[model samples]
Target: MSAAVRYDEVEAGQEIPAVDYNVRRLNLVMYAGASGDFNQIHWNERFAKMVGLPDVIAHGMFTMAQAGRFVTDWAGDPGAVVDFGVRFSSMVVVPDDDQGATVTVSGVVEEKLEDKKVVIGLTARSGDARVLSKARAVVQLT
Candidate 1:
């Protein structure tokens, strides 16, 4: 485990180390089962293509969850997140192959709040597309 990062030690514009989240077919299937989102686009490639998608696409909520994980892991406490939200700007095309699609997430402190909290701006990209936009998280620290 890494050392805990205190709110006093963080600086604005400091880049959080990026993490790549792999989305494989089985992973998507598991996510679908877990979230009860059986959207055909997330599992059936033919159905996805018929809907004008390139291939099976991952769910927007799945992508959002991955981004949330990025922030919580960085904060070292999932409960530290006070508020979190994201806008799904693009789809994450998932191909049925060993090299699954990778969603890269990174964040930076944008502003420090009054009571030992900070606003974190997040960016998530996958397959030459910006998947999440206007993603931000407010975290409380000690």
Candidate 2:
């Protein structure tokens, strides 16, 4: 899909609606299988605590992907994102309950660049801690 955001229509400091993504034990299990990252800290609560984590934590890549989804979803196309990066600031502790955990992502148009590209600044939080930091995406808009 092509980007639905027109470069001429967006301005710096504009806000994008926040999106909350659910992270459950099942989802982590699936990601571990697909990504070949079978680290016990991601799915085994006991193991996670034994390893000094608060609880079973979500994979760093999984959290990053969710944040990236927020940007791609806003641009209306995954391919429109020419660059994306983030630093894992905190762990998303996933409990074994039905409610699991929530990762809330919010974004802003940080700057407009040449060639119809824009820099989008992103923040992702879970519980009281920010899960991702320095999250940004460079998107090519039509």
Candidate 3:
């Protein structure tokens, strides 16, 4: 889908509506299968604890994908994203429960670059700790 946001319509510092993505144990299993990253830490609680993790942690790629989804959804086009990157700042602990965990993502238009491209600053948090940092996305608008 093409972005509804035109290059001239957006301004620096504009905020995109925040999104909360849910990550559950089942989702992790699905991701592991799809991505072929069958690391024990992501699915095995015993191995996770042995590795000094608090619990089964969500894969960094999973968290990054959620953040990327936030940006692409805002742009209204998955292909409109020209660049996207994030640093894993903290672990998202997922417990064996019905609710699992929630990752909240928010973004601000940091700058408007040349050629209808804009830089966006992103923040992703799970509980009280920031799970992703230095997250940024460059998107092209019509």
lDDT against the true structure, per candidate, is: 0.92, 0.95, 0.94
Give stretches of model 2 more than 4 Å off: 1-3
RMSD of each: 1.0, 1.3, 1.3
Better of 1 and 2 by lDDT: 2
TM-score of each: 0.96, 0.96, 0.95
Query: Per-residue lDDT of 34-139 in model 2, one digit per residue for the tens?
Result: 9999999999889999989989999999999999889888998878999999999999999999999999999999999999999999999998999999999999
Query: In terms of TM-score, how similar is model 1 to the real structure?
Result: 0.96
Predicted model with the maximum lDDT? 2
Relative to the true structure, candidate 1 has a C-alpha RMSD (angstroms) of 1.0
Give Cα distance to truth, residue 124, candidate 1, Å. Answer: 0.2
Q: Please write out the lDDT profile of model 1 over residues 1-142, one tens digit for every residue.
A: 3455698999888888889999998999999999999999999999999999999999999999999999888988888899999999999999999997999999999998989899999999997999999999999987
Predictions ranked by lDDT, top down?
2, 3, 1
Give the clashing pairs for model 1.
Answer: none
Q: Which ten residues in a row have the lowest lDDT in candidate 2?
A: 1-10
